[model samples]
Target: MTKTNAGRFFEDYAPGQVIHHAVPRTIKMGERALYHALYPARHALYSSDQFAQACGLPFSPLDDMIAFHVVFGKTVPDVSLNAVANLGYAEGRWLVPVWPGDTLRSVSEVIGVKENSNGKTGVVWVRTRGLNQHNEEVLSYVRWVMVRKRDASSAAPETVIPELAKVVDPSDLVLPKGLHFDNYDFTLAGEAHRWDDYDVGEKIDHVDGVTVEEAEHMMATRLWQNTAKVHFDATVRPDGSRLIYGGHVISLARTLSFNGLANAQMVVALNGGAHVNPCTSGMTVRAWSEVLDKAETSVPSVGALRLRLVATTGAPFALRGEDGKYLPEVLLDLDYWALIPR
Candidate 1:
């Protein structure tokens, strides 16, 4: 059996392809600790075993985004290894809550593919499902990536772009079953900002930069049970460079958002996001967010705010394009919706 290169080309992907990306991940307490340190996430469901037990779980689970990354990271090898840009994501939902010890594996089915007219790139859309050790579907979502063509001179194929939602409706939000917070401790949760405090168009700068280390990411990947060759086994890469798991950057940015957006509790929607550039070790990550829109929710205590969070390494606050493109040090541009205290 021939192994596909981790740096795959656009010409290599086809519609209806089912890619069972390699490596399985299992979440653990160390990863949980990192979550606590990375973000000021103090939800009782994730912070206390006693609280989780009262909530009917034996132990607290990792954050939902952590599970999302554990599952999404696996698809990088097959879906976006050679991607020019991550186009967008849509219809994402977390079906089941992930526990600390749950082992996760993901499978992505290619739903659409379109070659570019320029003949240098193409787009690939895939619906990915994250399954736990018990084979239960934990989360699922549709993501598309713009992939570079290995042979740019080839004729372009028929275009097939898929339609996607601009925002996931509040009714579409899926709260973990039994996720009631009658006794929710606002103190331990950190910060007093609630759903009503944030206004649309407001900007918040999360003032902290976590300097990443190879060992830190390696430990994180291992904690999630994500053993992708590029993420861990350095010898497998031609350049012998270990690719920092994109999830690490995502988590770092999300965690960093806690400073001013601490009340932006749950991530209700992921409209779009991009890991614009590679993040190597020793890069210090800093994040800032702008509230795009605000919406009322049935949960009166919390309102929803649409935000764009930017993560950068060494780049100063506020993204500027000298050449009309994102600065080289900019690591990510993410658009999402979060539940904030009302």
Candidate 2:
């Protein structure tokens, strides 16, 4: 049996280094089916091949987050093997739409490396680029992580911290080329929301719930090749329990919002995301969304809407601020940008 190359150590990276992550992944219809069932995603472009062609796509494409997971998973082996924490992401942009059969690969370049003042851990920033079979850059983002040094006795390296954006500018979000909904099918799109229909303060409670299972999450984690012991292998944790991947819940909530937010496609800006509580197998996950802000994209054909997508465990319906902050059922809070049809 072959051994797994999960992640790298701090000593293995250097500034200006470029790592081409391997294991190209081909998105399939089965993945699409899992996506739909996982989050109740109803976007015509990702729902039916027939409906997708009507929207000018060659075929149904995988969900955007799925593309992100595949690309990010590959970098784990070369970048975050001994990571203490994932600091943040910025300047993210999706350049191309991912089709069902497209093979995806990733390459990351070390943008900066700095030794922390404490001398025990350091920060590493890398720009990961996702590409398709034709070598087209599908998506790119700058992410940083805190890594621990194996030998604290060694002297610190150069202190060259890179300036990072606190929040990705809404104006910089890239719209997928040729993505216009001039003739967008509202019926198949599964929503009547038009570009002008949303208000800056509009709140939408996407009513849907999914009961997560150990087998389901394990399959997803293995599919992404994210072998973080806490996410799998229950024996590694003191509690003997597997921790669900935060990204899995994020994708779940984002997809569930599709019922009434189908036109709200293309995640442009990821403001911030948090997994409030630990999620385990057999937990029923529910979701709701709130329109925090809205902006016009340079893409004359679409509008950018910033939203807060929330995921809750053990709930069967949407969220309502009954006892003050997100109800006790809340499990996640994610802020992101989506491009909607104009």
Candidate 3:
């Protein structure tokens, strides 16, 4: 009997299967410190306990992306160990604030699967949920990955692509209890722009960039306990380059976004996202955002802004080429809702 995990292949997945991922992670301030060190995340609500209290949270919660990475990392071994590429995301939401001492684990249900034309790989769609120690659902999202087939001769699975929501409705957004941005301080938050200041279709160039290095990327991946072979073992890829975790690009882009959107405090929902291109070490990452739409939330003091966040190494704002495919330089395109002062 094999003592180690060989991981699941494309043919191993079937619709309606439930997988309880291994390992539960206890998020601590140490992880917070390391996260801050890894990215230029300086959002006020996540930075100061006093600030978070003023905004109605008892204390500063871990960064939203931190919770995301930790949860997504837990699913790597079972969901994406043999993945050739992470396809896309949809219908994601953060239901509850993750405290520093919270222990988080993940569970996933295989919602859809389809074999590729080449028979060398197939797409697997799984809806994953992150639960705290008390079994409360904290975060949830649907992601699809292209996993390699162990044997090309294996029979292809029946195609069952899930019809996911194109966007998370504004009314359905989950806000942390007592989270009111009425008392939000513009000074401490770093930017004076409020919800009313932004107009739909308006674009903002964050005007900052970070050069990512392999050392730091690997360290951050290890911090989340992600065991994806492609991220660690360079020999797995024919190009001999380690693929930077897509979540790293997300956090870095969100960090850089602070310069222009400091008051966009909490991420309530993830409408959709795509890793357009593979990012490697040595790329200088920059970010830009376009205000897609704005809506009033149930909380009188808080408003929601639908924003399109783009991470690219080339020019800003040029997402796709004439053919409608994402440009070669684009790394990530994310659409989400963030809470800002009304």
Which candidate number has the best TM-score? Answer: 3
Model 3: ten consecutive residues of lowest lDDT: 182-191
* Candidate 2: stretches off by over 4 Å: 1-6, 84-87, 112-123, 152-160, 166-171, 274-277, 298-301, 314-331
Candidate 3 or 1, higher TM-score: 3
The models' CA-based lDDT, in order, is 0.75, 0.76, 0.95
What is the full ranking by lDDT, best candidate first?
Answer: 3, 2, 1
Q: What value of lDDT does candidate 3 attain over all alpha carbons?
A: 0.95
List candidate 3 stretches off by more than 4 Å.
none
Give the per-residue lDDT of model 1 (tens digit) for 158-212.
5667677776776776655654445455676677776667777787878888898
Q: How do the residues 94-123 of candidate 2 rate in per-residue lDDT, one tens digit apiece?
A: 778887788999999998888787778888
- TM-score for all models, in order of appearance: 0.80, 0.82, 0.99
User: What is the C-alpha RMSD, rounded to one decimal, of candidate 1?
Assistant: 3.8
Local accuracy of candidate 3 as per-residue lDDT tens digits, 1-342: 879998999989999999999989999999999999999999999999999999998999999998899999999999999999998999999999899999999999999999999989999999999999999999999999999999999899889999999999999999999999888899999988989999999999999999999999999899998888999999999999999999999999999999899999899899999999999999999999999999999999999999999999988899988999999999999999999998
Listed per model in order, the count of residue pairs whose N, CA or C atoms clash below 3 Å is 9, 2, 0
Q: How close is candidate 2 to the true structure, as a TM-score?
A: 0.82
Candidate 2 C-alpha error for residue 75, in Å: 1.1
TM-score of 1: 0.80
